[model samples]
Target chain A: MLKYFEQLGHKLIEWITIAREFIRLFFETVFWLIVGPFKDKPVNFKSLFFQMVFMGVNSIIIVFFVTFFTGVVLAMQAAPQLDKMGAVIYVSSLVSISICRELGPVLTALVIAGRIGAAITAEIGSMKVNEQIEALETMAISPVRYLVAPKFLALVIMLPCLTIIGDASGIFGGYVVGTTSLKINAGLYLQTTWKFLSRKDIYTGLSKSVVFAMIIALVGAYQGLKTKGGAVGVGRATTISVVTSFILIIIADCILTGIYFFSDM
Target chain B: MPEKEIAISIQNLTKILGGRKVLDNVSFDIYRGEIFVIMGGSGHGKSTLLRNMTGALIPDSGKILFNGQDLLKLSVAERERVQRRFGMSFQSSALLDFLNVEENVSLPLVEHTKLSPKVIDIISKMKLSLVGLQGFEKYYPSELSGGMRKRAGLARAIAMDPEVVFYDEPTAGLDPVVCAVVDQLILDLTRKLKLTSIVVTHNMESVFRIADRIAMVFKGKVEQIGTREEIRNSKNPIVQQFIKGELEGPIQIT
Candidate 1:
């Protein structure tokens, strides 16, 4: 019985060690990515533009559709409950605050994880398997500077932008549901939502997005860079990256929520 | 010139894998402008030795001197700088599938040099032309045949005008005519560029066609080093067996 317990303890320790190494690599990659563009060499604007289009601009449609449905669902659920209490006017306010503070950022991150994270992993992993990364190294070009830094900057700058769009679209979605489905006054719904929503709530959503962007970019790039074997290896890395980024974003959202609520209290 | 002026010198190099010595205390020197071929049977540590020379693998114990500087002692940055002086072609012809032929050829120049895009493009086109791939620049790797991909890889290798170029099985997995074209390209490039070339191949025909000197690796050691005529006419039974393509000999096929 003691041997079995000891074996379990050993396995747990091994898992912890692996997790710690992964975290260390994550932060180290972030540190280099932040400092890379500011170094002696001039920044490659062309690469940066490509990354922005790839990571940010391309993700807009998905973000719009997701946030829109979320808002519609929120209004549909809240109207009947609030109508029973003679507080149907508060439904818009509830949708606004919930979407802006939590739902928008979290859902956008999940979508981007599947989209951007998978793309980065497949791209980098294929490069590894093909020796394109080694080819870059052999040319005296830093792969981190050329490949990773641009993607990191693009994600950091774009995730917040995406969240803002998501927040606005979600409010618009709520307005649609309130006016059409709930037979609420459109002007009254918009005015109550604007009055109830504060800058703090919007800022919280954008802040969570920044952290999610870091996690997605770092995890995706790490898995891609470390890919081994060949096609099968790249496929495995991409799957792991998407799944891991999704889980990390949720955990980060929960922790940030706890801090935001408790600290205010 | 004295032997000490060798371009590359390896001493007591060893690499262990799975509790067995893949390379055991192997040592050799390559001259400044000679074609050095490391010929061996498959899995005879030939490619491993080439990778070690290029600083892609760290040996368990050894010293590698390039231009009399200890390559193993350099920092990663310093080693990368040294590595830039050479070019490498892989056995798999590892071309970037996303890039067209011209873009793939122009990669090293775009990464390392301050040349304008126009000049880079022109030079890339010239490289493709040099490799007999003039009309194929706009095509992707998938669009090209296997032989064309190998030639495209060669174009990329010489894109930087490297001092030393390493070829890992340049003629493997190709028909005889394609193999001859690749071999001829190796010879032409060596002569025209005056580059120090090291090729790891088991193809005897390729060795005869391009090698200025051949170093046959056997059981993790250099079994012989000689000119084409000397290797062909030598009385060494192992060399004789290998040249004759015999399945039975001192070489154990496991």
Candidate 2:
């Protein structure tokens, strides 16, 4: 028991240090974002554009399919149960609410955590190993501004855009299921979705996308900048970054949902 | 050159990595407009000291004084302002693989300089030509041979005409012919650009050929620093072992 507590204490301290580093990278990235335009180098539009295309444009197809199938699956499972209760019409309400308030942002964030988060960590980790990041420093270029800033700003903008798309794709998938498979009235399905869904729900979900984006960016950058060893170290960083981003996204989702539930947002 | 102004003064800079003293109270002065090489065996602290000099790695203690400023003591913004004129060549070249040679060479200017694109282009070409990489401007770093990649990196390093250029093992993995070419290039460019150079290398031949002076690091400490003649005729056992590539010496075989 004593040894267990000792190990627990060590792990706790390790996690605390990691969290500290993560927060530092988060604030540093944000500070770079605010001051980026005033510097001699200014904002790197070329890299920023590339990052948006990489993170948002490239992620659309996978996000669409994942959310689409998810919507289909959600409707398939929930509709039958609701239909047995003589409340088949409520399926639209359930689908729309889940997609807008939870599924869209959360699923999109998870997919992005697996995809873009891994890529960011690997790319920066490789740069660190090769000393390109240090080369940037010696040249007076903050790796944060040149590397993390573009990706951070791009993801902060793009994750929401992807979430909006995912929300639409999911609803469409649910609509298809409702009309064809579930045999619900099309007009009623549309009407029910419109009646139940409010701007607050959609706004809340989209806002979660912004937080999730920052988490992914910060976790990836922190792991990457702290990477040592070499290629093997980069692989480890990529793995840890994805896992940490996923965990943070889920935990953040729960916290935000609890806040909205209690605070009337 | 009689006054021999100090370009960089490292005062007892120490760095501990994983509990090992990577840079143990290293102190040296790189004179203005000369080729200064830091030589050591593989595990010694030459490269670490070079990293410290570049202001990329803050030491556990001591100071790296450059341009009337201590690099370790400055804020991030201030360090970057001072680093604007610095240049570094990495062991693996470290050129952006996605960018072509010309683009890599022009990165510093494009990011920092207010020069017109047309003028930047001309300067990029000139710097590439100086490194004998003019014809390979369109070739990406991945496509270039090892020697050619090093040349391209050097082209980029000197593109800004930086006051102090740091070269980390400029000819680590190359043939004798390529190594000679690299040595010649370093000599020619440092002279032509009138820039002070701090080179970290364990290559004895390269050091004797290119260095105006040499600082030999042994077991994480600076063992000896002097002119080529002084170092060549030094009484230090570890320095003699390192420079001569001998196994039988005061340095314990790990």
Candidate 3:
């Protein structure tokens, strides 16, 4: 029991150390992003543009396909339950509300955590292992300013935009099911989606996506910068980054959802 | 020995890694325009010492005084100001893989200076040419040979015209011919650029060829420091064992 407690204590300490470092990295990136431009030491916007292209533009197809299919599944499942209640027309509202309020943001974040999150870890991990990060330091360059800040900015901006796209595609998928399979009128379907999908629902999802974006970017960069060993280390960091981001995204979503659900917002 | 200007004075520098003293109170002075080589077998903390001096790894304790200003005592902004005068060439040539050679060389210049792109381009070309990597400017690091990569790394290190240049195992994984070429470049650049060069390596041949003075580290300590000839004739058994490449010595193989 004593040995187990000792092991537990060590694990706790390790986790705390990691958390501290991660927080430090996050704040440092934020500091650079905010203060860099005024000092004539701006976060490299050219690199930021490239990162935006990779993290945002490149991710559209995957986000579209995933959410679209999810929308189709949601509509299909809801049709039967509503049919039994003699409320088959309510399928459109169910699909849109859920897609905008819950599914779109969560799914898009998960995909990004797997895609761009893994990429960030792999790239930075390899750089860390190769001593390129140290080289940057020796050149009086902050790796956070040069690498992570741009990535953070790009992801923060792009993830919400992607979520909006995901929401649209998912609702479109539901539209297909409603009009074709359920034989609902086309105009009514869109009207029902708009009616049920309040501005609050869309904003809440967008806000959740922003937080999720921060989690993915920071977690990926933190793991990447912390990576040691060699090729194996990069692989391990990438895995942990994705897994950690996934967990954090869900936890954050739950907390935000709780806040939104419980409190009068 | 008469009043040579000290470029960098390392005072009782100690660094502990994984609860082990990787650098145990090591102290040394590297004079301007001299090639100071820190040579030791693998894992004796030579690289760690280099890292400490270059400000890549902060020492657990002790001072790295660059021209009498303590690096550790400075504010982050001041430390960076001092750091801008130093450049480090990594063993793996750690060039950003995505960046072509010209961009890699121009990185320090681009980051530290507000030079126009045209001037940065010209300066990068000059630095590349100094390392004999002129025409390969457009080629990415992945496309370069090991020797060319090292050269490109060297070009990047010198981009800022730094006062002190640290080379971590510059010729570690090169063919003998390429190793000799790198050694010659180190010697030529040291003279031509008038830069203080600190090299960390276990490559004995390159050490003898390029180093004005050599410091042999053993068990996280500076076992001996001397001129090449002095080190060649040193009475220290550990130094002799290392220089002679003998199996039986004070240094345990384990």
Identify the leading candidate in terms of lDDT. 3
Please give the lDDT score for candidate 2. Answer: 0.90
Clashing pairs in 2: none
**Per-residue lDDT value at A134 in model 3:** 86
* Cα RMSD of predicted structure 2: 2.0
- Candidate models: Cα lDDT each: 0.87, 0.90, 0.94
For candidate 2, write residues B1-254 as lDDT tens digits: 38989889999888999999898888888888999999988889888888888887778999889966788778988877778678889999999876899998999998888899999999999999998877888998889999999999998898888899999999999998999999999998889889999899988899999999999888899888999999999999888888898989898877
lDDT of 1 at B15: 91
Name the regions of candidate 1 deviating beyond 4 angstroms: A1-43, B1-5, B17-20, B233-240
What clash pairs does model 3 have? none
Considering lDDT, which of the candidate structures 2 and 3 is the better prediction for this target?
3
Candidate 3 ranges beyond 4 A from true positions = none
| Interface RMSD values for all candidates | 2.1, 1.3, 0.8
Ranking under lDDT, best-scoring first? 3, 2, 1
TM-score of chain A of each: 0.92, 0.96, 0.99
Model 2 lDDT tens row, A1-265? 8999999999999999988877888888888888766755566888899999999999999999999988888899998799789998888889899999999999999999999999999999999999888888788777888899999999999999999999999998889999998898899999999999999899999999999999998888888988888999999999999999999999999999888766774
lDDT of 1 by residue, A98-145 (tens): 999999999999999999999989999999998888766656676666
What is the Å distance of residue B32 in model 2 from its true position? Answer: 1.7
**Candidate 1 colliding pairs:** none
